[model samples]
Target: MDWKLENIILGVTDVDRAKEFYTQSLGFHLDVDHQASDDFRVVQVTPVGSGCSVTFGVGLNGAEPGATKGLHLVVEDIEAAYAELEGRGVVSSGIQHFDVATGGMAPGVDPEHRDFMSYVYLNDPDGNSWHVQEAHHKGAEG
Candidate 1:
């Protein structure tokens, strides 16, 4: 059986604001915007080259605005991703890597640009954090 991850629902205080951030700042493709009533609205957006998409809006139960965190978006190049976010006025942390030898975080991307080693973080308007990581080995079969 094949299982696929599709949509992730994000709790957001303002759907329009979230839509703007994702579409304009993050450059995600706006997939859907639907409102059944004043109490029910959902907006879906997908990152470029991503199969999975995120949804946010009103009337989704048990979702607290700004509560979601640690979502990862993998990129082939951390520098390019960081540059794009910066160009869009998104405040992102400097590229960083965890030093396994020293067991501490260090400034800059991984020296070797190793998969899963380098990351930069940005937050949505509602404070939901997203991590962009350099992952060059994804989908390669052993």
Candidate 2:
């Protein structure tokens, strides 16, 4: 059996603000924004090359606004991704890596740019955090 992940429902306080942030700032493709009534609204947006999408709007889920955290968006090039997001005016944390020995974050991407080692973080209007992780391995060494 093949199981595919589809939409992730994010509870945001404002629908229009979240839509703008995802569409304009993050460059996600706006898939849908439908409101049948004042109590029901659904907005879906997907990243450029992602199969999974995110949905947020009024009365969709009971989750609290800004409750989601640690969502990862894997990318092939950390530097390019960082530059693109920064150029688009998204406030992102400087690329950093986790130090296993000290269990702390170190400045800058991993020296070798190893897969899963480098990351840059950003937050949406509702404070839902997203991590752009470098997941491309150049070769056996990387």
Candidates' C-alpha lDDT? 0.89, 0.89
Q: What are the per-residue Cα lDDT tens digits for candidate 2 across 24-129?
A: 9999999999999999999999999999999999888656899999999999888889999999999999789877778898988777777788899999998999
- Model 2 stretches astray by more than 4 angstroms: 137-140
Candidate 1 lDDT, 1-142, residue by residue in tens: 9899998989988889999999999999999999999989989999999999999988876458889999999998888898999899999887998888998879997887778888998899999999998888444221
What TM-score, to 2 decimals, does candidate 2 have?
0.93
List TM-score per model, in order.
0.93, 0.93
Clashes of 1: 0
After superposing candidate 1 on the true structure, give the runs of residues whose Cα lies further than 4 Å from its correct spot: 137-142
> Considering only N, C-alpha and C atoms within 3 Å, which residue pairs clash in candidate 1?
none
Model 2 poorest ten-residue lDDT run? 133-142
